[model samples]
Target: MTFQLRVLLVLAPILLPLRSSISQESAPTTTPLHRIVPQTPAELRELFRYTATRLPIVSAHRGGAGPGYPENCIATFEHTLAETFSMLEIDPRMTRDGHVVLHHDATLDRTTTGTGKLADKTLAELKQLRLKDSEGNVTDYQIPTLDEALRWAKGKTILVLDQKDVPLETRVGKISQHKAEAYAMMIVGSFKDVVACHRLNRDIMMEVMIPSHAKVQAFDALGVPWQNVIAFLGHVPPTDPSLYEAVHQKGASTMIGTSRNLDRVFHRRVRDAPDSLRRDYQMILGRGADVIETDLPREIGRLLYAPLSKSPLGHRLLRVE
Candidate 1:
């Protein structure tokens, strides 16, 4: 036989077993991933494809809480497992003891009852401090380690590690060791950091987070389809298209918002205020964004995915909603 046919013959047996092993049980629900693990890369890729059709999927900015779970707490991460959100945004940092832990802000004062730098605290000390909600009310939730968060991702939604202040190598290393691709998978991290991490481990999904409209070129060249672009509303007289276009032309998807990635914006920032946050959303949607991360993901899905709009993912979301 020819070389190509011979190679195909050699690989067929190895591939058949993987296809057979995909035990897809339709997005597990027991406390957010109580069942399912051991997924193949092919199965994971297919799942990602189907979910993208439901674009603008809810991504709990900090793993959405249930009734009373504080934001970014383990409870919230578990709750997210039950939601339809295709992804979750989580922040991870290192403790003084060199253990990986989860928290958003670089400092510890705003989130926990503790009053010092997070890096200054040992894992035991960090765990001693209870986490607080946005209202500054303390709850029973203690800080969680990265291992806990990964456990929540097991055969559930994707994890988008928003480790803005952590070293890329460290974050990527932990995710790889877990073999998260067998469960949910991650974008690994934001724009600048992910570039280095991708070169080190190209199999990992990379996401870019932008504060300003610069640096889309370097991020797009990395060949990843998803890049989380931060959407803003200030500094223009309205009708600004430069930044979104810059990212879209690079073949990477843009995550726009009237504010940051949440798709909510300040009403005061829009010059004419004619552009509702949704209008601003449509602008980037027009740019062919592969995904839109918004707090109002349901509304965006309704409008963009409306029957008449021809949005690729809209139909499915509308039916579900």
Candidate 2:
């Protein structure tokens, strides 16, 4: 071959890899929400710990009930995950025939076209009812089951299962059956429930009510690893801010409920004011909360992602030392 031909061949291998690398870099990729979730318990623990320092986890209250999508419906979940890195707070209730389904209210009158108590209906009966939005307008979405929700959340956002009326055994059974311990967590009300859930599945993550330091100690006493716990401090602004620190020392994170404060008397000054809302969020973050469970996850996520100067509060987010 001539010298010119040999030179062209020498450049081909080098140029090809460079072009391929550029093409891969330029291609659009899925966001963290759409990517496969953490499969191990240790990875999930690190996710929470790292996220606390980065951005506070935004949990959509009632799966983010709004205009088109109804609360606890699959459509709402998909919409939220597509928009942001969010955790869906869903209520699980049992049907009359023992199927676990998602519905916020004990009765179906407020959120669905159906009437009477939700427990009185079977899965088939629940499926027949169309869901309603916050405005009470009927939508085409049907009630989703725990199984469906778990499966859907497998590779998407994390799910915070509010143990509304479902028994611990039922919830644990579903989580295990779906192999969803990495992406699913249940809001346990009592120590008994926490112990029961831990005993059933050692890797099952739990969100427990920890109103005070004593409660934190109680949880520690249970001998369940703190790595699997996220402390829920309730709707009221915590009276003891140190509880956040205390819990952190135990290798767990804390979640503050801002949804209830939206209507409470103490929060009246900040309830309607945009600036005050931002300040309130800053205060919560300053207090060392790792997650903010809100009725307005979309709005909060937007605000949290904004720069410190552009944030409505006009201040930087407080970091836990």
Predicted structure with the largest lDDT when compared to the true one: 2
Worst 10 residues of 1 by lDDT: 16-25
| TM-score for each model | 0.63, 0.80
Q: Superpose all Cα atoms of candidate 2 onto the true structure and report the RMSD in Å to 1 decimal.
A: 14.1
Superposed by TM-score, candidate 2 places the C-alpha of residue 111 at a distance from the truth, in angstroms, of 0.7
User: Listing every candidate in turn, what is its Cα RMSD in Å to the true structure after a full C-alpha superposition?
Assistant: 12.8, 14.1
Q: lDDT per residue, candidate 2, 184-229, as tens digits?
A: 9888989998988999999889988988988988888998888888
lDDT of 1 by residue, 180-298 (tens): 75453344434555556757665565454543455555555656444222222232212445665554454344443332532334223222343354344444444334354544322
**Superposition TM-score, candidate 2 onto the true structure:** 0.80
